[model samples]
Target: MSTIRWTEDHSRRSARWHSENHSPLPRRVVVADDRMRADHACRHAADGTALLWRGDFHNARQLLQAMGRRLDRRPPRPGSTPSESFDLHRRSRAHRAGILGKVLVLLEDDYTIALRRAPDVRLACQEAYGPPQGPVIVSLRELLGVIGARQWRVKGVDVPALDARIHPHYGVFSPVRGEYVDLVAHTPLPSTIEHRSVTTTAFDLGTGTGVLAAVLARRGVERVVATDISPRALACAKENIHRLALSGRIDVKGPCLFPEGRADLIVCNPPWLPARPTGPVEQGVYDPDSTMLNGFLTQLTAHLRPGGEGWLVLSDLAEHLGLRTRRQLLAAIHEAGLRVTDRVDTKPGHPRAQNTTDPLHAARSAEITSLWRLTSATWPPRASRHDPCAGAVRSALRRGPGSC
Candidate 1:
């Protein structure tokens, strides 16, 4: 039996099974077997109950698919405000995902996951759950994700910005969303810095796979200091830099949010939303109360060299979702003592943006990603700064943080 917490209370409870889905604490969990009918199982799940399958592996998958079809035919709430409607849609999707993810699979005591047609996912599992000490139960749906992620880790994501593949670890954020990376690659370097003898250095805060850092290094930035709070992310970034033969140019550091000292340019792409993540994997997508984003803005000026620019890559989806507002963001920026000099905007061409059936489609369709070029309000530039694109490179080469 696995010891898990009952979310309602702080008490610990033991169960033979646990959910592997994104939800960490399911309110209701019930055990089921091969003898259980799919209709009965579906009804139980529809009532906000969790079904832990201990049945034929393939049958569990089929049951999950059946539940999915039912959810597709479910009607949307009518007569609700746009915000309420959007929230309802989000809830509906979350409910369906939770129900379908109940398909349970077993992990053998020897650290092997047994399921029909399942690929070898020991490495991926280790990356997530660590060495499987003994037999444990996990969600088959998540196992499938792990399997797919393993393939992604092997093949890597092709970054047009760097003209190279950035291999991401299982838990690290992948560079699948290329629009922001493209913005980073094309954004004009700030002109205030005199880029002459030594090359100007840049800082890439929250560098997950180091894609942006690699992009900066490729753009002739002499050095890049990539920082992250996760050791796993740091390791992943280092491996990618090494793979690209830019390890000598880009330095990976952390357990820290920002590298020590300052640089000519700093790039940060915080999680686009201000919401709580249910699990570690979701942290790259959802930020609680916009903590990381705010932290970057508040401390950015201190780390920027005189006349330096801080590139902030963000999306307006949260604003559309009503979770945040433009006024609130602008106020935060003002409070941080930073002012946006200019911004480059791009519309997302991802599949979700085109799917009208998606619950957040309205927001997704209207979503605009912008790279805000910002500078400290109090920092006086040595020279007049105007056209970011027409500036000549004349800065002395500087060593990045840690001088790797």
Candidate 2:
């Protein structure tokens, strides 16, 4: 809990600084009100100075928008390659967010804003920050994000596969993209493990909203265990599971990626991109160095019952962007002593996939989400170490109907 100090009313004052993204505390702070011009605010922000807003709440929002428009006037130059373009686009976005984050607001001990026209944000703040410790200072941009997340939590996202809505908690990734969920719903479940009489058991790894676990339970999996490495995600999954009345069928646990025992079926939808995330929410979108992906692959065989299968729901968008390659992915599976039995592919129907103006439109347009069925190789597998793709075989077992 870092504290930020500033002078007001000829007296020194300070408050705890809060940033979900862990941004550094401002070196300089000054009070600004309704009289502050957008250009002046931009100048202060460009100079790495923070503005403590004391004016009408709506007016502050307008000023923030004005500053954004000014920043947008000068866009980053386009790159020659898709990878370069992606890197430049990310830098531009980070720069924009940094400038806009200069606008700050203060909340009292109980999460109340003193400015006029400020809506009651106590509930939203409590949900995001837990019990309030004392007066806290946060960027106006982050505060707005918290408010928007509250609305989404209240309204919830409807999953066609589950025929229900999943309420995502603050910092938890929502299931806005339903293509992966559909693949899980439609995949054929293994009837029985080889040489053993066992009941149907499934595990959902890195379950964010528990959408896939819910889908598995609905598909008649006798017992389902959902694991996550985030406390917020675990709580969110438990709530959703309880709401769907599948609490009896599914057990939510963790701060761990994999639970204690093996399962007949293990499913994982790791983050698609192999890059570092900029914020908490992006954790679900990016996995630095493909750590989660490789972890799942390397340890997958140990957590599977004989004749059992592992379902890997992943997107080829990273490959299209040149961040990863099919050869490397196949090599990884081979080295892990796992063989790809089958794969189911689906094209994303997200608006960005069709948007021509997006910087990564080329990759998005060609993105293919797949559900890969994997199983352990026989003892003393024949594939040589140099032949990584020898055991990797991809037969299109199924193709999803249409865009989600």
Candidate 3:
């Protein structure tokens, strides 16, 4: 446990501190006042020195922004391919975050962050850092992020499919991306699952905001068991369920991937990328070695009733990034004793996909999000129903939001 040490000439002091990415503690630190220039700040940060800002809080923010602009102006790597450019871009952004993180801000023992233009972020801090025992130090960039997250908590993410708002707690992933949720929303329930009594149960693995679970309930599923390993996610899901008045219909639990007893339907939207998350907050976006994804596949058949269906929502961006292959995904499913019954593919409508200048735009534009319907491999694929009217409607949904 590395702690940040700051001792004034008059009083000795120390506080619980560590870099966001666990970078080595700077061997040299300088007290930066309002007079420090962006060039000088950039030089100090580039040299791996910490800058304890004693200046106005707003001014410190300006200096951090200046450093960001300087980093952005650096020349692009010459003759890099789109993939290489994408990789380089991620590295550059991370580097910038590290540099900006050196601008330190202090949190008073009373939970008041000592800086100008700083809002009362005590609730936000408590959510992320737990109750502050006493005074502590944090980066200005992170403080801003906390404030932004607080705003997000208040505003909540709107799920048009569910016709409700999912208030995301700090550290829980927000459902701003709706295409995948649409896949779950518009998906037709399994006939066996729907016809088996009035109460058909489904499990939402890694349920974040409970948006998917809520969508399932709205689509007429009677009982939904939502499970997650994140305490924050569990709380968020429960809160969202309560807000939608679906508390009785959906059960939220923590520290587990699957609930006991088989379900008629199981759905999961695991992290697409198979890399380690740099921080706790990144867990929703990156899964080291595709643990959750593979784990869900391998265990899905056992938890699914004989005629049940498993919906796996995934993206092919990893394939585009050369991280994983389509063949690998197919093999994982087969090894899990599951086979794809049908798939609904949709292109992302996010702004990044249309932004040609983005380093990963090519891959983003080429990305396809698929909702795979899975069942026991021993059981043959479901017989296709010959209904042109239904096929036309499903074809439109499969093509995505605007393809029709």
Flag regions of model 3 displaced more than 4 Å: 9-11, 18-24, 75-86, 385-394, 397-404
Q: RMSD (Cα, Å) of candidate 2?
A: 3.3
Superposed model 1: Cα runs more than 4 Å off: 1-36, 46-55, 75-82, 114-118, 192-199, 381-404
TM-score of each: 0.84, 0.94, 0.92
Between candidates 2 and 3, the one scoring higher on TM-score is: 2
Best by TM-score: 2
Candidate 3 Cα lDDT to native: 0.81
Q: What clash pairs does model 1 have?
A: 194-394, 194-395, 195-393, 195-394, 195-395, 196-394, 196-395, 198-396, 198-397, 199-397
Q: What is the lDDT of residue 289 in candidate 2?
A: 95
Compose the digit string of candidate 3's lDDT tens values, residues 19-95. Answer: 44566666666678799999999989889888888778778888989988998887456325555665676677788
Ranked by TM-score, top first: 2, 3, 1
User: What TM-score should be assigned to candidate 1?
Assistant: 0.84
How far is each candidate from the true structure, as Cα RMSD in Å? Answer: 7.2, 3.3, 3.1
lDDT (10s digit) by residue, model 1, range 214-323: 99999888889999997778888999999999999999999888889999999999999887665556778988889999999999999988889999999888888888
Name the weakest run of 10 consecutive residues (lDDT summed) in model 1.
395-404
